[model samples]
Target chain A: MLLEWILGFVFLIVKLTIVLIILLTVAAYLVWVERKLLGRIQARYGPNRAGEFGLLQPLADLVKLITKEDTVPQEANKGIFLLAPGVVGLMALLIFAVVPFGSGVTLWGRSIPLVITDLNVGLLFILALSSISVYGIALGGWASNSKYSLLGGIRGAAQMISYEVPMGLSLVPVVMLARSFSLVEITNAQSARPFIFVQPVSFILFLIAALAEIKRIPFDLPEAENELGAGYHTEYSGMRFGLFFLGEYITMIILGSLIAVFFLGGWHGPLLPPIIWFLLKVGIIVFTLIWFRATFPRIRYDQLMNTGWKVLIPIALLNIVVTGALVLGTS
Target chain B: MGTIKNLAEGITALLKGLATTLKILSRKPVTEQYPEYRRPLPARSRAVIVLTRDPDGEERCVACYLCSAVCPVSCISMQSAEREDGRRYPRWFRINFARCIYCGLCEEACPTLAIQLTPNFETSGRDILKLVYEKEDLLVNHGGKNNEYNFYKRAGVAMVGDKGTQINEDKPVDLKSNLP
Candidate 1:
């Protein structure tokens, strides 16, 4: 029993270390990807001087963020203000625990699940954790005691909640097809047949809804620079602001991975190993997200909400119903 | 009937919107990668002004200061002096291109056909002083294609003679005779 406990602790540490490395690297590259892709779209050269093709630009940004002085508002809620970004960053990192990087392999004389935990209700767990990220935004805005931040927070909360319905509904067909809340099972089912082929409409709804959830362009109402002056995390500075920035990109990576696993047959391909296939799929999805960001303009708040509640929600419901009927009829 | 028609119209509109997006997605991007592909400037493009000489390589300017006077940006500065042969000439001509708006008005106002706009528009410089074109830098050996036709010779402006030698005036119009 003692040996088992020690082994578990070691495994936990290993998983945590892996998650940390992946999150930091993904977040850093996301900045590079955004600049390079946006530059191409705008007919301008993005950062190409920091390192070879500006690969080290993110590192330079991190150094700048670190060296800068941490500023705090005199009238701000010091406790909540300090804790907000930490909450966001931690929540973003935690969501990666259940993300199956590859199938189980025998390690140290035991079969390991590759994932940190393969909980039966993994999907629900992810949803719950993702929902908790909203608190960080809300808390940041409220603690700042700034009107713009307050408005941003209120808008972010409403937007997130409104989109979550369609986002959740979009996943219903996948769950129905896989017949399990377990991410591993869903991935396994996807190997047999990618869900995108069967549920293209649901995939589209999920992409749009997920983009909204992550507050990307066309749905980036929370931090509308022109409208809200940096939005919920406006007053945040130094490492605190960096943490929020980190959280945002990490969320993008996680969503990209989720999309890959759910619809694009995660880790399933010929010749290349499973991990490589998974990375390739995630990379493609992330590129598509960045492409959309560069190409499209931000939607207005009312329009965003209308699209979510009125348009997406109905379509997602219809998709689920149709998927259900098709599955039943086929079976 | 109206509700059903509205629904059909909405569906058609949505499909049309989707089709447009798909068309754009399939088409090649319209972006022109500049620096690699330079665009051709139009014939009448007013990029920069240059001073021109006659075919005989004589300076066409008579130091009239018309270009300087008409310059909107006040970029042109020149001093006029009479030569030993009693011919007007510019002693020093300078144009601070940094301040010049390249409006082509100076070219239009040069009565002597000395100034003309050129096609060379890429004039960016690291230093402001480098942009200031002196007389030597602005002067060109050939009269620009259109300015080859001398305005002074064609307009009956006498250069060396009194009123009787002026062209097209019929010996000062014989003002005492009023001939039919």
Candidate 2:
């Protein structure tokens, strides 16, 4: 029994290490990808200087961030200010623990799941963790003792909380159809047909809400750069700022994965390995997000609120009701 | 019905915008990498200043002080001195290119066409003193814009030749003759 426990512990560590490394590396490269894509879309060659096509730019940026000074504001809350970026970074990383990239595999007479831990209430866990990450932004801004930072923090808190309603409501249909809170079960339920075909409304609602949740373009009022002068992270410098940046990018990837798992039928495709199919779906979603950044203008604050509260929430609630009825009738 | 139609229009507009950017993504970027490529500048483009010689291989500048007087930034200065052949020359011509605005006013003010602007504008240097060009640095062997122009030859000066022997001048009326 002890040997079995030890073996399971070792397997968990190995999987955790692999997934963490992949996530960090991919997050780093996504910055390069976003820059290059945004450049190409706008008729410019972005960052072709560091190495071949600026593949080494992220490395250079990492080195630069590390060597720089970690500054703290003179008249600010020191402890929360220091901890804020780490909170954001840690929460983003933690959410990935429940994300299943592939089905379990049997090796040496033992079955090992691809994900770190297949929590039963994975979706709620994600929503809760994301909600908690709001504190990171809010506290980071509040502790800075600057007017711009405080305003940005307030906007971020309000926007995130408002959007979470529609985001949660949209997922109700998915849960209704799949009949389980477990992500693995949701993926299994979609082996025949992905939920996107049945509930495209939910997919769209989730997408818009997810974009806002991740603080992407058109919904990026928190750190709008023009308005808040980098918003919550105005006082952050060096690797602390790097931490906020890393958190943003990792959340992007996480949201992409969540979208893939929820809507596009996670890891269930013919003529390709499950993991490859999973990655391809995530890649397409990520590219689309970047394309959205290039194409769309940032909506006004009033418009953002109207879209989230007035339009998205109503649509999502209606979608859930309709989906629940249809699911019951069909089942 | 109006609200529904409005929604349809909004969705299509968003899609159209996405399509436009998508099309641009496939096209080649217009960025010209500097260091790797340099475009050809026009010949008349004003840049670095130079001192040009006359077609006879003689210094065309008479050091008349007109260019120095006309320089708005006071970048140009020279000490005028007469040579052995009664030819006027600058003893120590200097142009503080650091102070020069490259307005081409000095070029316009130079009657002899000795002081001219060149198309080679890459005069940047780490040392401020290096940008202060002396007479030797500015002097070029050939005429700049017009090779045939010899200021002394056209003028009524006796330095190049006797007054009547000049190419474009009529024979000076003999002062001893009582002819009108």
Candidate 3:
């Protein structure tokens, strides 16, 4: 019995190590991918010098960030300043603990799941952990003792709180359809027909809310470069800045995966393996996000808040009601 | 009903923007990939300063300090000296390329056709000191822009030959024996 426990523990550690390595590498490369896409959109070449097609830019950026001086402001709260980026980066990564990448496969007479942990309330866990990342931005900004940083911090708090409502409400229909909080179960429910086909309205609502949730373009008022000088991370430098960047990109990947799981039928397609399908869905979502960025200019702050509170929240509530009625009528 | 129409218009506009960007994304990049493929510059493009020789294979610059004086950044400086034949030339001309704005003012101020701006702009160097060019560094053994322009020939300096030996010479210098 003790031998079995030890083996399970060792495998768990191995899985955790593998996920972390892959996640970090993917997060780094996603930045490169975004830049390359943005450059192409703008009719220019982006970062083609470091390695072939700028494949090694992330490596060069890593070295630069690591070697740079970690500067602390004179009047800043040093402890929180040091720890805030950790909160953001770590929380972003922690959300992936429950995400099911692919189904289980038996090896050596034992079934090993692809995911690190299959939490029953995986979706809730993701939402909650993502909420925690806001603190990192707010605290990091407030700790800097700069006016722009303070404003950015305030903007982040307000924006996140407003958008979180619509984002949560958008996912209610998915939960109703799947009848389970487990990400794996939710995915399995859509194995035949994706939630997107049935709940197209909710899907659109979810995507819009997800963009705001991630503070992407037209909703990125917190990190408004023109107004707030990079918003919550204005005073952050070196690897601390890198940590915030890592957090942002990791969140992008997580958002991409969640969108895949909820609406597009996670890891489900014909011919191709579930893992490939999952990644393909994610790649499409990421490309769409980049396209949105390239296409849309930043909306006004008032417009952002108004859209969330007035438009999206009401629509999501109505969607839930409509979905509930349809589900009852059909069943 | 009007609001729905407006929303549809807005979305359509956004879709149009996406299509435009997507089209750009598919097209070939206009980047020259500089250093690997240099774009041919215009002939009059001002960049590095060079001293050119006259058609007679003699130094053309009289070093009258006009170029140095007219230089906006004061990047040019030189010592003027008269040769044994009374032809003036720069003893030691220097141009601090670090300060050079490539304004071509020095080229414009030059009386002789010696000081010319070349289209070669690849003057980047790791060392600041390496950017400084002296007379020998700037001087080239070929006439630039207007090759036939000789300052001495035009200025009536009796350097190459005495008066009347050259076409434009007023008369031979009245040396006492020649006068007799």
What lDDT does candidate 3 reach at residue B41? 93
After superposition, candidate 3 runs with Cα above 4 Å error: A45-47, A68-78, A143-152, A226-229, A234-237, A327-331, B53-94, B111-114, B152-180
Error of 1 at B148 (Å): 32
**Pairs clashing within candidate 2:** none
Instruction: For candidate 3, list the clashing residue pairs, or say none.
Output: none
Candidate 1, pairs of clashing residues: none
- Best to worst by DockQ, what's the order? 2, 3, 1
Going through the candidates in order, what is chain B's TM-score?
0.72, 0.81, 0.83
- Writing each residue's lDDT as its tens digit, candidate 2 over B19-120 gives 999999998999999778987888788999999999999888889999999999999999999999999999889999999999999899999999999899
> Which residue ranges in model 1 land beyond 4 Å of their true spot?
B1-180
Give the Å error, residue A35, model 3. 2.9
Q: Is candidate 2 or candidate 3 better by DockQ?
A: 2
- Highest TM-score: which candidate? 3
- The superposed Cα distance between candidate 3 and the true structure at residue A237, in angstroms, equals 4.3
What is candidate 1's lDDT per residue for A1-331, written digit by digit as tens? 9999998899889877876887798789898888876675555567777899899999999998999999988899999999999999989888887888787778879887778888788888888888898889888988999988888888888888888889899999999999999999999998878999988998989999989998998799999999999999999888899999999989989998899889988788889988888889989888877776765678888899888989999999999889899889989
Q: Report the candidate with higher DockQ, 1 versus 2.
A: 2
Models sorted by TM-score, best on top: 3, 2, 1
Candidate 1 interface RMS: 5.5
Q: Is the docking of candidate 2 incorrect, acceptable, medium or high quality?
A: medium
Q: Among all windows of ten consecutive residues in candidate 2 chain B, which has the lowest summed lDDT?
A: B34-43
lDDT of 3: 0.90
Docking class of 3: medium
The share of true interface contacts that also appear in candidate 2 amounts to 0.89
Per-residue lDDT for A193 in model 1?
Answer: 84
